[model samples]
Target: MKISANQTKNSLFQKIEQVRHRQGKVRDSHITLAHGSGGKAMRDLIDDIFVSNFDNPILSQLEDQASLNLASLMQQGDRLALTTDSYVVDPLFFPSSDIGELAINGTVNDLAVSGAKPLYLTCSVILEEGLPVETLRRVAASMKKAALKAGIKIVTGDTKVVHRGAADKLFINTAGVGVIPKEVNISAHNIQPGDLVIINGELGNHGAAILIARGELALETNIESDCQPLHDLVETILKVCPDIHAMRDATRGGLATVLNEFALSSQVGIRINEESIPVREEVKGVCEILGLDPLYLANEGKLVVVVGQENAENVLSAMKSHPSGKNACIIGEVIPSPPGIVLLKTAFNAERIVDMLVGEQLPRIC
Candidate 1:
């Protein structure tokens, strides 16, 4: 028997689905320069890569701007925190995240770690002339969704086109506004000897994932970037231990950089127990194979908290309740030692020094 018109229509739809599915296959080891140009290559990159990984309602909408309705009550305080960062990842996109998501999270994390509740954000786009409009839309859409998840708004933005060779395919600069409650205060200068060190979760995942995505180092691991928003987690910690001495997000310089900065700012030393620090076996193995130090590896979602000794358990309890902080642990403490130094206690009872990365290990990674 001949197929009905309805059945013919159904068959056509199935054929279209198969065609779309075939467009996203990843055969190349690295992103070709064509991936950024707003053409067939760029469309494939966004549809197959970004959307597949960060599937969400706001993202699925694929609109020029994400519709949001933030509560006015959330912006009560006169005190506010503002932060900005430029996204310049050499590869632009990585295993777990791209410059788009990183730009959002990076600014939000800075505000969160500073005890501010982020509210509004402004994004500036520098697009290379040949860049595809579709890719730009995808990135803007990602920013909108990330801002919504962080409870912030993309209130204002600007776009500028640059000569093809003058700039990378794209670079994003994001600035955020946040309200700081009068009662909450987190500062590196507030750190004191005898305070305890608590980390939100495992380190090196974001860094390791970036290195692998670059395809330079031949190593394999399941580590994906831990890039995420941290406002909710920060809020919980503040609620339980309102007297927290200091809080910082471990980003570019990793735990070592932030810790050393804190030590210097507070004029104190930090003693970290090697056993207490959390590291995934996969990340550790990758680090070992590459001769990279986990301590200096970057992290996106993780946080470092220094709280008074009496409130350690309270802060830890708060941290554990949040998804981002489920693996939180007391890693070390502030101590009276040589000013601005961080000491690591090894598994073999040996002491070693940990310092800031000289320049950059995995460069252009957020």
Candidate 2:
């Protein structure tokens, strides 16, 4: 049988992806502005590359709007949860995700970690004057798709253009509103000494992927930003266990920063099993190569959940069954022994203090 040229190229690309995935390396030499332009290049990039790897029903629809039914939303609460975030990821585009998607996911995750059902969002963009309009359209469309997938609506938006050097091609800011049941009380102060510390998935992929994509560090590994909106995952978990003590999305400062904040807020110590934490092999390699610690890296999609010890298993199970929570695990537990301290039990049978980031390690990493 003979295959068409497109098929031949796709097959070759798939084979290349297979090897890269197995070895954890990206073959792209560098990113060009054309990749963002909404033309054949952009479509091919999304279809032949990103969709091929991160394919999902929500993302595959490739539609202008994603229809959602919110008939049951009213019963949750009368008050709404609101959050806003700005994406200034320097390159704008990275291995696994881009700034537009990050803006949506970050804002949605903020509401999700707060135990809210995300509903509506407003997007504002700052574009370099010289940037192609097509690029802006694709990003806008991507944001629309992401919002739809998360069952949220982008009811309003604004766009502004800056001088070429004033902005780095593009920056996206989003504000989101969500509703939480009045009875659902999840807060840092609610955490207890006996509560368990759970993480939804592996850490540090986003930071390291950004580093590699920009060619800042020379390392051979296949990793991409674990960027996704977590509202659905949060919804599923809350439905099963509404009594979650506290939740936080480990973003700019990774697990250590969030843990430290939680520890201080609850006036309790946290003891984590280093061995229990999940770190992808490629991410580990990148961290080792760059002399970076995964604990302090940024993550856009993953969350830290603190629940009663007895409910830990149920929460982990609930998270694991969800697509976003496949690698969810119990990494640590709260304790009263050392108030406001985060202790790490190393794989080598040693203990160390996990401190908050004093200064920036990866500046502008977000």
Candidate 3:
């Protein structure tokens, strides 16, 4: 077979055009201002770090807004649930988790605690100029893995680069949308006397993990952040006890903050025994040494659940059967008197108020 020179030139031109249009690797080692200028550099960054990892049909179109199927969402439930959060913890990478996984799990927990089946998520990241491109790739890979494990998709997102001195290493913001069934209604307003206070597992792991990551205290211990998605655990609870009065993830403000919110919202008092609350010995040692209260520490995967007295045992049993709620326990019960107050009964038979955090205990603990 004989090929003409003109045909060879035409083939070469077509191949070059294809390479220019297709998704490819980012060539720069460190991020620059030009990467966020809506030009070729930005496209390369998104294609290499984000779109390639968060590959999905909706995001593949490269549109400004995600095009969703209304009928598809309706099939899951009658109502839509939405939540948004930002992650700016110092030291973007921590033990067992990073800012990327934290952002996905945090938003998912928000939706799950509301009795919604998490469906989709939108991710946006602010990158400081001069950040290593590998760091961005690592974060994007983690987000992809976390979203995949949670059975959710990243449908749309944006990226911006700031001056190196103006911002930290990297920050991520995420918004999630889910579907809430008609039968499920979980809220703080539904709390009442005779309800049981339940927590999924040990508290303060996240705060302790972050503190250790920051190297503020000279300590040594094997502890990891309890960062995880909780939709499955919530679903397990819904199957057994659909009439949950109130439920919330013990996140930034931890167990005390959540209990106080329930009490104030429902105008009822919550009494929990100190012995019933779970805390790792390492965490306790850290708190005790630092003269800090573990109850107010942050947690990424723990939740405070309040259910009717009749359904308390059933919910507890169901939660214990799940992976996230293995240490589930009823720490307290709602009392009729002293509305808007949370009473913590110490192990020595003494009691005190458990109030919301007044000021920053551990900064940037997200």
Candidate 4:
């Protein structure tokens, strides 16, 4: 019998529901090497876990690579931005987010801060033998939710299992593609002297959260990772001030490192006011106890913005209007003297060098 279009749609929904319900029913609680051997076990694992959570037409094809139509993509913008990042945060899970969410947001933010409209992503995971299937289910679900929240799709992916000791419980890598509008010209080289430096919210929350979650601190606080995608925030800022000099998501090396990079690239000095840089009291306390500087601590959701002095107030106002940038403030400005240096004007009226982080502060952080 031939089925009607509505009947076919209903049948597909039923099958999808069935697949979703079978998420954690794997016979083995822990992953095995056979699950990555490209055999029936591997197929079943992918079908039961990743495919079930990340259900979409493009991904359902299960092709070796996603085939994207260029004509549709080209209609959005003139340039394409591609970024890839890996998430290996320890503990695999954290208070506000996990490795899966981090993997998605990190890649999305990378494309977003480059003045691009993030579109699609590819995910690849390394699963350690003996890792719980339940853990994988949770992570995959988180990734699916985050991708939907970011208005993007996980169109393709791969999974592999390694010996228990050969890998962590779970590690994820994601690559993203975005389109940059022709009018948006953002780059560190575009930074000119007198440009103001602005940031979208408090710093070091992600690094602090990860450190506390490690259980080595034996301390307690309400701090959580500021892990979030910044594309909407960037789009908002650009709508108001399209001529912004530069933008960067302060990630592994944090705000200080970003300033150094800007200073060196533009051949200008950055003078920041320590008092103006926003930091939550909880993060500050953690940094104090650990003897870590909040300036160098990593952040997942924060952004560093540079705009001409004339547009600083307007840009700050635009940023403040966005939920993600509500705590935005002007932290510094570009200076002509002493090129390739970043100086901090302390609250005490003293000056010090804000240099790049020399060594690893919090390893395994996103």
* Local accuracy of candidate 1 as per-residue lDDT tens digits, 1-366: 999999999987975675468444644444455655667765565566545444344444656665544455355655668788888876767776777888999999999888888877767667786666556556756765786688776655545556678888888888887888878878999999999999999999998888888788767667789999999999999988778899999998899999999999999999999999999999999988878999999899999999999999999998998999999999999999977999999999999989867988888877
How well is each residue in 1-366 modelled by candidate 3, as lDDT tens digits? Answer: 899999999987875664455545688889999999999899889887888788777987889999999999999899999999999998889999999999999999999999999999999999999999988888988999999999999999999999989899898999999999989999999988998899999999999999999987899888899999999999999999889989999998889999888889989999999999999999999999998899999999998899999999999999999999999999999998799999999988999998899988899887
- For 51-94, candidate 4 gives per-residue lDDT tens digits of 88887778888999998889988998999999998888997888
**Sort by TM-score, best first: what order?**
4, 3, 1, 2
Better of 1 and 2 by TM-score: 1
The residue ranges of model 3 lying beyond 4 angstroms of the native Cα positions read 1-24
* Better by TM-score, candidate 3 or 1: 3
Please report, as a residue range, the 10-residue window in candidate 4 with the lowest summed lDDT: 18-27
At residue 70, candidate 4 shows an lDDT of 94
Q: Candidate 3 vs. truth: CA RMSD?
A: 6.2
The residue ranges of model 1 lying beyond 4 angstroms of the native Cα positions read 1-75
Whole-model lDDT, candidate 1? 0.81
lDDT of 2 by residue, 1-366 (tens): 988999999987986775345331223333344444656544554454344333434434555543433565567686678889888886777886787788888998999888888877766666675675556545655766776688776655444556668778778788887888887899999999889999999999898888888876656567889999998898888878899999999999899999999999989999999999999988888778778899999998899999998888988999999999989999988999799999999999899999998887687677
Clashing pairs in 2: 24-221, 24-222, 25-221, 25-222
Among all windows of ten consecutive residues in candidate 1, which has the lowest summed lDDT? 50-59
TM-score to native of every candidate shown: 0.80, 0.79, 0.94, 0.96
Alpha-carbon RMSD of each model: 8.8, 10.7, 6.2, 2.3
Off by over 4 Å in 4: 1-25
